[model samples]
Target: LLWETMILPIIRGNKLDGYVLGTKLCPPEFLPRTTPGSTVKIPNPEYEEWLSNDQLLLGWLYSTMSSDIASQLMQKATSKELWDGAKELSGAQTRSRIVYYKAELQKTKKGGMKMEEYLTTMKAIADNLAMAGNPIPLPDLIVQILSGLDAEYTPIVTLLTDKISVSWIELQTNLLTYESRLEQLHTYQTDGIQANHASAHFATSSTTNRPFTSTNGRGQNRYYNGRGARGRSRGRGGRSSVSSSSSFCSRRIVSASCHLFYKSTTLFHNLGMCPQIMKCRYNWSYIKF
Candidate 1:
C-alpha cells in the first residue's frame, strides 16, 4: 500500500521533480554558469531550477525512507541515484528472499490453525515477495495455497482448481465458508457422541440402584442390594460386605473386580458374580464390561 501510494507514482514520472520514468531530467551543458574567472560563479537559472527540483525529490525520498536506508544513500547526489541505490540493495537480497517466501508458501499447512490465521500467513508471505519486486502471479499463488492446505480442505481446493480464473477475494470467501462448514460438522459429531454417552450412563445408573430379592426352597430369603460402578452393594443375610467397583457380598472376600454377594439361610457365598449385571473393568486406555 505504501508503495502504491507514494513510491510507485513518483517513480513513473514528474517533470517538476526533475524525474521522467525514474531518471533525473538533466539540464543541458549550456545551462551551467560561465561566469568570469572570479571563482564565485553562480549557476544559471535553468541549472539552478533543476538542482532545486532534484533536492526536493531527494528530500522527499529520505523523509519516506527508514533511517538505515537513508543512511546508506547519503552519498547519492540525486533522487534517481538514491532510488537506484535502494533498488540495488533490494535486488541483492531479492533472490534469497523470494526463495524463502516461495518455500514457506509451498510448505505451510493449515493444521490446527484457524482459517484466518492460515490465510494471513499465506497473504503476508506473498506481500513480502511483492515488496521484493518478485510478486508471485495470482494463479501460481493459488496453486501454492491449495498445496499447503491440509487434506480436509481438498474438496474446496479441487473446486477452485477446476476454475479457469479465481480472484483472490473469491478464494478467501470460499475457504472461510468451507472452514465454517467443517466446524459445523465437528460440532454435530461431538453432540451425537455426548448424547450416546448420556444414554448409556442413565441406563447403567438406573438398573444398578435397586434391591433384588430371591427366595430359597426352605422359606429362606436372600436380598441383594445393587450399586453402580463406583458404589457398594450389601447382603442382608450377613453382616459382612466387601467393596469394589460393584459390590462383594461375602463373609471373607477381597478382589478388585465387580462382584455380588448373597447369603442363604445355610451359609454365605464367597465372591459371586452379579446376576444379569454388567461387571466393569477400568484402565488408563479404555473401559470394559
Candidate 2:
C-alpha cells in the first residue's frame, strides 16, 4: 500500500532520480553578497525548492512510522540515508521474527490436540520460519512431528522411523491416512461388539423357546439354560444307572449356530463335538424342569 501511494508516485515524477543515480541534480547555489562586511549563505531558488520537496517526502515516510522508528530516521539529512535506515531496521525485525518462529516450533507438541490440528499448526509455523529465513530440514521436521505424537500414534511413528527416507508431503499424507484408518478400525470394533451382543441375545431367546428332549432313565423332558455354553443333565440313562453329570462346552469351539441337546443324559457337549441340532435323532420337548 505504501509503495503504491508514496514510492511509486515519487519514482514516476522523477523526484528520486538524484537518489537512484547517486548524483545531486539540484545542487545548492550561493547568493550574491548584499553588504561589504556581512557574511551570509543563502541557497538558490531551485535548491531551496528541492530541499522543501525532499523534506515533504521524508515527512510522509515518518508519518507512517512509529515514534521509536521515526526517531531513528529523523537525523538523516538525505532521502538515501532515510531509506537505508528503514531497510536495516526491517532486516533486523525479520531476523527477530525468524528466531521467534524457531522457538515456537520447538515448543509445539501434540498433547491433547487432534493429529490434524497439530500437524496444521506445525506446518504453519514451519512456513513462517522458512519465510523468516530459517527453513527446517525435512528429515528433522519429520522426526520432530513423530516425537511429539501421542501414545495412540506409536504404531505409525514406528512405521515412519523404520524407513530410511521420507518426504514431507508423503509424511503428511501418510499421517492423515493412518488417522482415518484408525478411526474406521475403532468404529468397526465397536460395531462388531454390538452386533455380537445382539446376535447372542437373539440366539439364546430362540433356543430357549424351542422344544428339548431328555435322555435319562426316568424319561423326563426338560429345557436347558441358554445364557452360556454350559450343559445341564438329570439322570444318566446307561444300563448301569449312573447319576447325571454336567459339563460346560468350550466357548472357543462353539459357533453361533450351536444349540443345546442331550444324548443319553450325557449332555451333547460331552461328546467334545459341536452339536448339529438338525442332524440329531433325539425327540424335542418344551418342559423347563
Best by lDDT: 2
What are the TM-scores, per candidate, against the unseen true structure?
A: 0.64, 0.50
Question: Can you write out model 2's per-residue Cα lDDT over 190-265, one digit (the tens) per residue?
Answer: 5544544554555454445343455656655455445544355666563332222221212321233233222222
Model 1, runs deviating above 4 Å:
1-5, 11-43, 212-220, 226-289
- lDDT for 51 in candidate 1 is 75
Clashes of each: 1, 1
- Please give the lDDT score for candidate 1: 0.62
Error of 2 at 64 (Å): 5.1
lDDT of candidate 1 over 98-169, digit per residue (tens): 899878887897788898899889989999888766788989988888887889888999999999999999
The weakest ten consecutive residues by lDDT in model 1 span 257-266
